[model samples]
Target chain A: MKRTDVTARLLPKLVKASASAEQFAPSNIALCKYWGKRDAELNLPINASLSVSLDYLGTHTRLIPIEGQVDEVWLNGQQLQPGARFSRKVSAFIDLFRRDQTLCFKVETRNNIPTAAGLASSASGFAALTLALNDALALDLPPEALSILARMGSGSACRSLFEGFVEWRMGQREDGLDSHGIPLDASWPGFCIGLVEVDAAEKAVDSRSGMQRTVETAHLYQSWPLQAAADMSKLQQAIQERDFSLLGQTAEQNALSMHATMIASWPPLLYWQPDSVAAMQKVWQLRAQGLELYFTMDAGPNLKLLFQRQDRDVVLQHFPNLETVEPFGSE
Target chain B: MKRTDVTARLLPKLVKASASAEQFAPSNIALCKYWGKRDAELNLPINASLSVSLDYLGTHTRLIPIEGQVDEVWLNGQQLQPGARFSRKVSAFIDLFRRDQTLCFKVETRNNIPTAAGLASSASGFAALTLALNDALALDLPPEALSILARMGSGSACRSLFEGFVEWRMGQREDGLDSHGIPLDASWPGFCIGLVEVDAAEKAVDSRSGMQRTVETAHLYQSWPLQAAADMSKLQQAIQERDFSLLGQTAEQNALSMHATMIASWPPLLYWQPDSVAAMQKVWQLRAQGLELYFTMDAGPNLKLLFQRQDRDVVLQHFPNLETVEPFGSE
Candidate 1:
């Protein structure tokens, strides 16, 4: 048995030694694109793409051990299903590395960010999970391996394995050995993201359903890989140079391109709500009035405002209806 | 004066022959792609796309001379302002062509397809006008030139000029001379389209508002040109090859892509009804269950199903909740 496993039986002694693991998993926004997969088993992207991890919004997860239980997981006070779409791959990870031992993982998850608003929920969730699992098991998987595992959960989650901007390198080799997430820089500073949460009450069509339908029916699906690969290269270079206009433009474009692939998929579908449009119109009207706000969207209605920290007040006036508008910065 | 023009002025002499010139304009579906100006002055596309001119779905517009009136215009039976969006565009065309004539354009417009449903109303309206103007003036611009005139009214409208499968070539020359609609195939016989009008309420955001906002704010607006161009090429190839799987997929993707661009646009928005998602989910589930239905969507909640005429029964079973459904074929 591993030393960590034995600590559970000898709980009082383990408490005296006092070990806890906490990690910050920031949200990610795709710049280049990674949509569609060449190898489902390996979770390989049809193309590479770049993404930026934000400083302000994400999940802060801490893992501690309890005395009696064999194995348990408490996510934000809710005992999560190891089978959850977000945490399924993590369960697979735990099963693989800690094969012989059992321990209760007391996870106190604090998600400061909104869930299912299409703002990289998986990225933060998985990033925090990576740190928690890494410390809890005392198993060391290189960042690349961790990313590959994360990719199995959600393709964008892989980007969260690192800080600042990163790229999920769509490896060329067919065997899928080189495919992994690599950090570009932790250098982005003075940037803050303001969110406009359009109160879109409509149910979102699961992306998984859309993606599957698209692959089966969308004639344009094959073209996405090449376009996504090209977009990734363009965005990587732009991010490396800290080109805000280019970064903002590329990220927005990539997101739309990804959504376009969905639109062009067979049975042509959408995830947009009426409120989403109203919010977008309000934003554009504000910009036309010269507020200088740049918008980015994921699959859902809420928008992320990428602007200089100082320009927030001017931008906030435009989105008076947002439920919560807060500052986001990276350490 | 030509015999027709002289006869038109003498209302009693103008029999049904001149009245035949006023066949109600049918609505058209933009097939290839229409976006950003190759020449904003001329309203040319960055790339060519294909659109089908519908027979059943359209608007009924008529012009009648009023005695002692130099000029008068009515839209949808309302004495709308000459500056109303549709009227203004129509007026501009008339002014450019018939500068010397004072004609009353009495338009009694009625939509067979649901209003504010994403099916292209203007595509049909302008298409009808192109034909109507030609008949009214005896200024027979060939189909290609008529398309250029229609292009000025709305980018997507130009595609409706051709019957069956048509492609709008986004000509490369800077003078904007080459962008015009051309038939991809002389016949679109095999395909039958069924429209499922879900929740027949007026759309909150019209395409004009949705598209304009998309252009101004959606970060995805920048990448639209490149993606749309590629889609046009692929769609043309798929149509020419007579591959239903390919055609269905590309069309579906294109429709979704347009919506994505809408969502990515500022004030993040959707024109979808709550029932739109439900209707689509039902279709997807039906398709998954081995139904032969392949569907596409415009901006509205209405769904366009493209399949052989024989597949109507299978498709109809899935849409029990729609407001109305009607099918059309080239025959």
Candidate 2:
């Protein structure tokens, strides 16, 4: 109680700070879902996961250097007070940038992608923040090192720094030095993600909390980590071979399996809305009718269809609302 | 070509009926979802399952014994043409009654619950049809014998005949003698089911075909049978002990696990609608706020909440539209 005399009651906000920067990072759709955490301290995932970074949807975060001690945050251009949960989230994320503890950095993050709506905004948001800070602080960290730092902010964020296909390998080391995104491929030229965004009114339970609850309660989750590892290898090979059918099938199964673990958790967490179910059924119907396409969903209602660039017309014919975003590294 | 077989083309709808009877059976919500099949010929489930028959919603079938080559099916008073899929299903079902194959009986079935919407109308439908046929055909079958016969009609239908907690055990024998619903308890006095009905414009893939695909693929489905058996026993004991917390938690987890198996299938079968997800979220939110309740969904969008009668007022407060049904056997 006596310590309040000399010390600040709260952590410092960016009311007054110095260095600042701005950067953009694309969103990623997990072909393999990251459903559980092996280590909560380092934000390490239980299973290795693969994702394709999206070129269309992304987060553009601009760091505004304020002169105050406490860091402020503005998301989607809305001002967030210093001590709020969101501001603290930003400050805590920026604090993960190794060399800075004394100086406060205000982060102004805008998501073209919706935040906390199962759209993987956290992935793009933290990825953008980490990358911007990299240039601003002149960290000179390579993609792998930066991925490790980004993972400290959000598990899926590590995969967003890379352009094309990325894998967040759940390493065995306790220090999490090896737990970082490995760029699987720089190009998936013929494949595109047909993103059907579903605007859910409420935010889902965040991935962190969802994973924690799943790991603690879901008995069926015991076998998922090993299964994901096997799937990751098969998918990587499928990509290398340019086998669209194999790649699409494995990605679809992987996404479903990941959701299964969460769905099996005590009190269950279901991410699919009615529209999501309808969209999935439609995908099945299309494939049954000889359409060479597959679909996967993240933690939210937005569905990503993996189909060839050649079959884009047919896919568009069925899902007129699907926003076609070229796979990362396609441009 | 041979002579045009025009004379046998027309099968009489209701030529000369010897016996007829009408019966009603309530729909059952599977707490432990049955996904795969061990014996398709006998309609045996791949795993043991537990279910609670809903008192509020049911099916009523009127058996019209007809002297014809084939059975005609009239669902909700609409006559289905002979040799159609629905007629064939009815014919095949009635054929399991151990009667002369040449004796065709017309089945007029009506469901208070929606059919094929995942609310398990087939279970109730087949159960009522079988029970009615038992009386009409003068087949003096006990509940166990009738359950086995119902199982041959539809896998889940075996559980619909009994009240309170029921388990459909996947028997050890290949002959399927022991694989029938064993009523765990006759009454759960304090409990009630809050039902939220959702309308689906289209029918999902029926359970039979869905199970076939899931069993053939879905790497995670291999261990579900044994896991389900284990869960069945634990759930049975929980119901016997009247431990609502343990019962509710296990039921919720078991339902999710069953859905997980299907969701992980080759072409994932998701039965939840938007309203289904919303209702489930509401249940989780209620539990978090210290409400003692649990939820489970069948293969459709409709959701059933299990809570004590004492908690009915609060449950109704949140879900004013929820149809409150007392536990079966309470009357």
Q: Pick the candidate with the highest lDDT.
A: 2
lDDT of 1 by residue, A32-88 (tens): 766667766555677787766766578887877666534356566787765564455
What docking class should model 1 receive?
incorrect
Q: Which stretches of candidate 1 lie over 4 Å from their true place?
A: A1-24, A60-70, A80-89, A100-121, A136-154, A174-177, A198-212, A226-242, A267-269, A320-331, B1-25, B28-254, B257-331
The top-ranked prediction according to TM-score is 2
Q: What are the DockQ scores of the candidates, in order? A: 0.19, 0.38
Q: How does chain B score by TM in each prediction? A: 0.80, 0.87
lDDT of 2 at B288: 90
What is the two-chain DockQ of model 2?
0.38
